[model samples]
Target: MKLTHWWPTALNPISNVAFLRPIDGGMKLAMLFQLAIAASAFSLHAIAAARPNIVLIYVDDLGFGDVSCNGAKAISTPNVDRLAARGLRFTDGHCTSATCTPSRYGMLTGEYPWRKKGTGVLPGDAGLIIEPGRATLASILQQSGYRTGVIGKWHLGLGDGTLNWNGKIAPGPLEIGFDECFLIPATGDRVPCVYVENHHVFGLDPNDPIQVDYKNPVGTEPTGREHPELLKMKLTHGHDFTIVNGISRIGYMSGGKSARWVDEDMADVITHRAVDFMERNQAQPFFLYFAYHDIHVPRVPHARFAGKSGMGPRGDAILEMDWCTGQVLDALERLQLTEKTLVIFTSDNGPVLDDGYVDDAVEKLGSHQPSGPYKGGKYSLYEGGTRVPFLVSWPGRIRAGESSALVCQIDFLASLGALTGTDLSQIKTAGDSQNVLPALLGESQIGRQELVEQGGGNQLALRSGNWKFLPAFAPKNAPAKARPLELFDLNQDPGETTNLASQYPERVNEMRQRLEQIQKNP
Candidate 1:
């Protein structure tokens, strides 16, 4: 009997066995009935086992309107466009925070980064932020038998307090749940400036160990500040401390010459690792967080992509990132994993031009708007800072369309947990990660009822439907900046230019109390 048609036959097994007992009367009828039930159960198990592999393509500092599908016309992002066209593109999706570290923490842990202290942008040497053995995205998926890995840009920090760069690095990604990890310790503009595979630095020569210090400069390396003539890229501000590969960085490092990664080859290198992960785990259900460092600070595209975009290094880097995305897409197609995989493409935060670099991003920008119609960028408490492009595609599983649901990156833990049949309630501590799986699967238009967005300085904003409230709060240790309580009806004023707090005092009060209540909770 066919397995698809065996379920109904197996449901009435006793009756069939009884009916056939009088006629042909043998143990064969009973055996057939058992076979049907066994086949049906096995079929169901097989269907459940065929969980789609997940690939989350996380880009660093890509804005809402950075791709053509999101209204960017100056430069084309064909690969990103293909992913968007094949999936559900979100119009109102957002990252949990407007920066890398906090957004990553919230996205993986399912908790508000602000709920925990010391989640701000971390230096390359900072201790591990996600407490070990915590219920994390990787842990949950790993429990469900999915091979998990995070490749590129892990700004969540590494090791416990005093990390020796040459020694084994623990309590990092592997401790958190990932089976394999290849990381740039912090951001591209920060230091130690080396690629880390598992625990040790990738290419460290034992003869000349490695040393990192955030406070003072170390070794005899030339810096953009001390040796201006030796620099290939000019520093605008804070990133002039330690120089590696002709670019000054935030912290200081010495030795590990062979391990230092080239800025221009970053895209290609990370792409290769991501593809390798996919190919290696092609037969198993794997979860890959393929984070890209392209289009971030020190926008240095590979030589082949140089001058391709008329805008400048920024635009050229975007094109280079698009090509990297194409490489992954092609890999999936070649491996025949396209239909068997769920791919999500999104950015860590909004866009910013002239972010401590003189890359001509501000001067060469023409009619292109990075944040689309929203206001502010990166560090500001504005829609453009937190709101980003979010797309989810799973062939034959999720229908393709544009969704206006208010979704967030923080929901991924619960959402994916639900997908893989994990009992989330038992795990308990998944702070604020709601299972909006229906909305994520393109089955419902509804998403989160409310969300909290954090900007640069632990400053927070609340979103409820079309209304957004930004309650005035004094800065922690700094002098007051005379900021007023603000409100905006996002449906009417998508730009957030007009503050209607004076008009609707009651709504502001209600949202403020609700925001305070959330913040006050354990």
Candidate 2:
């Protein structure tokens, strides 16, 4: 038997006088016991060393086909491709929702955002959606002796309803278990265009108090609606409000001009900040949630990557995102943490061209399929909307390969909890997260047997094995078109072109009922 195991059994008779006496093999027994104790300590140290430093690279609005590894020829994601080459690349991975806010909420909380009201997209100055003491992904890891930090776009909202941008912001990432945080209060296209490091604005001047208003105009700045000449990028839709760095955002902002971040310099700024976090926490196991704000609305690449991609600003932004990924990977290598780190790359949702501004995303598109073989993109209840790029890499540990495992970001809570040896049974708030660590690490081909996909307007679809079902429902405030239930055998129709609702009525009914039950209970 192993010395570590045998030592514990032999330790039962420690108090016995006969066992302690230096007679016969008693001296040899003492030496063996000392050796066994040393062996046990070494075994424990090895186990602790095995717990890797996790770096989750969550990208925004990046499609499955945007990376070269996923079949994109227009733009190359060498850094993301490098990750796929080193570890398992999931072919059928997904986010919980089609939109950014809900998907992010689902990913962190491990609970379906649709089940909880007020989890939708928030304004620039909305309150904290996540309750302060709830069990979250970061909190779980934090409890497992991991130093947790988040840097980048934190659209999950901050503070209570009455948030003071100039003062300390409470009920934020710090309150929810993150030891460190450097975040954008909302999306880049939103107002209050400043960075929030921990609690206060990064470079806010006390004299220049910040004021933000979404309803009525607050600042005397030129808006996209009034001054079209001031805009460096033109708007195609409703992103016409106060101008902050030659671009009008969704809301109005008055002060904190010194703290305002330049749109072109955002990637560089955040990339450096992320590297610094890793450097500071390299001595121990750290969980860095590096969310990237790239290839999203107002696609403004830095001057270095301005015209790199011939496909315009959107493609250029993709290249920029790839560079950011490279920066993080290079940092890991520099810090000698490559093999000791577990990195996961994925997107919040699918991609959408012309989300708000017109940056030639559609015009310069020359035979580039953003969603690859999927049907829809962004806000629709189709395969393309929620299916995103999911790549995981842990050098020397996770074998390099491809997996068709049916996995979702919602499972990160339980899967990672299992990885860190946290007692998941004690975490009652992990609503729908399942421990899919084996699947995530490429040890198993199967993941979740069924997954729930959410699109815009709280529309949902169900996926069971190779079959997908979409229930019939009329959209709000729209003309009530006679829409029928839809079903597809995904193995045959991955693009979701054929609607087999008429032929398979019984299966549709069963799936619809199952979906309803999940919604009601989950």
Candidate 3:
């Protein structure tokens, strides 16, 4: 039970309720006794034998074309690229959902986010998405004796349906599985724009109470919709609420000025917290989910990386993320935990420039293709929306190779569970997850036989072997049109430019029937 705030000097501090004493001559002995007991209990709960450390580096809105390792030439990502060179690069890896909140739910629970109602895109004040009694990846990993911690983004709701910014919010990340947590309440562009460590909001000023609303403004905070002159980045759509760091966000907010995070230092802050958490738990097998808030909206890069990218704020933020990766890697090497640790790098969804801000992601584009020849961007049913750069590195443990295996990010929980000798007996929805450990290690080039995909736009596609089947459904968020039933041989045309529906009616009907069967189960 080690817990502490952003204290770099002290490093890992033991978390105990006994530290509440004012003056105690026998506190040291009591503390030591408690520590020993906790160690024993934690160890007993964990699996026998030493399990390899797990680190899942999740990035925000990073597309297949964002990383140098994934056919990206315009930007530099030496650290991520080098890691890809050391292990397996999964070209066909995908998140369950094409949006943030849903993808996170699927990734953590191994269940489709759509199964939970209204989990498409969560507002900051939304309640905890996962039920309180559910079994999460963090919970399972904790049972397997891993010290779990989550740093950065936590879009999965917190507290009950009603969250009070001033009061204590219970049953959050710590209750779910993470032994320790430092997180952004929801997003950099959302309301209650502050950080939370454990159960309390960090650096909250008592005199100045916090306030937030999405439907109606509090009439106190500056907004981009009415006060355009106060903003640095202009708005395009939904993100025209309260302004912070000269950028307007999605919802309204006020108070907690001192506690508000600096937009430019967001990357460094999250990276440092992750590195620090790893350093603290290096002695034990640990699971650190370092979710980076990069390449998302309000793309504010630090001064050093501000103009490094010619493609505008989106590209600039990516460079900053690359730098953060380098920093995390450097820390891992410095602590000598690289070989013993497992690193899985991936993105929540694909890319979308000009999502809401006027960061020049659309206007400044020259020859850069964010989706890499793919049809659609974020919030679409096209391959580019969910397909992203998925890489796993374990130094000498995993072989270095590029695999076109059809593995989903949701499979990681089961795959890693197998690595730690865990049986999914305690986990209820183990039905959705498949163990692909061999595929992840590059020992098997082939992966799942049939994988389903969700475009955040509400379109569904199924991939079985080399063929992809998309039934007759018009594209959402676009004009009405009767789309023909489609089936394409992906092996022949990876770009999915041509629809072979009319040519292969039999295959389309076969796949459509199979999809009905899979969807019917559970």
Q: Candidate 1: what lDDT?
A: 0.86
Instruction: Rank candidates, lDDT, best first.
Output: 2, 1, 3
TM-score against truth, every candidate:
0.90, 0.90, 0.89
- CA lDDT of 165 in candidate 1? 92
Model 3 worst lDDT run, 10 consecutive residues:
7-16
Q: How big is the positional error of residue 16 in model 3, measured in Å on the Cα after superposition?
A: 38
lDDT of 2 by residue, 440-467 (tens): 8786686777889998868889998889
Q: After superposition, how far is residue 114 of candidate 1 from its true place, in Å?
A: 0.3
Summarize candidate 3's per-residue lDDT along 249-288 as a digit string, tens digits. Answer: 8888898887889899988888889999988998999999
- What do the candidate models score in CA lDDT, each in turn? 0.86, 0.87, 0.80
As for candidate 1, its clashing pairs are none
Return the lDDT, model 1, position 506. Answer: 92
Q: What is the lDDT of residue 8 in candidate 2?
A: 28
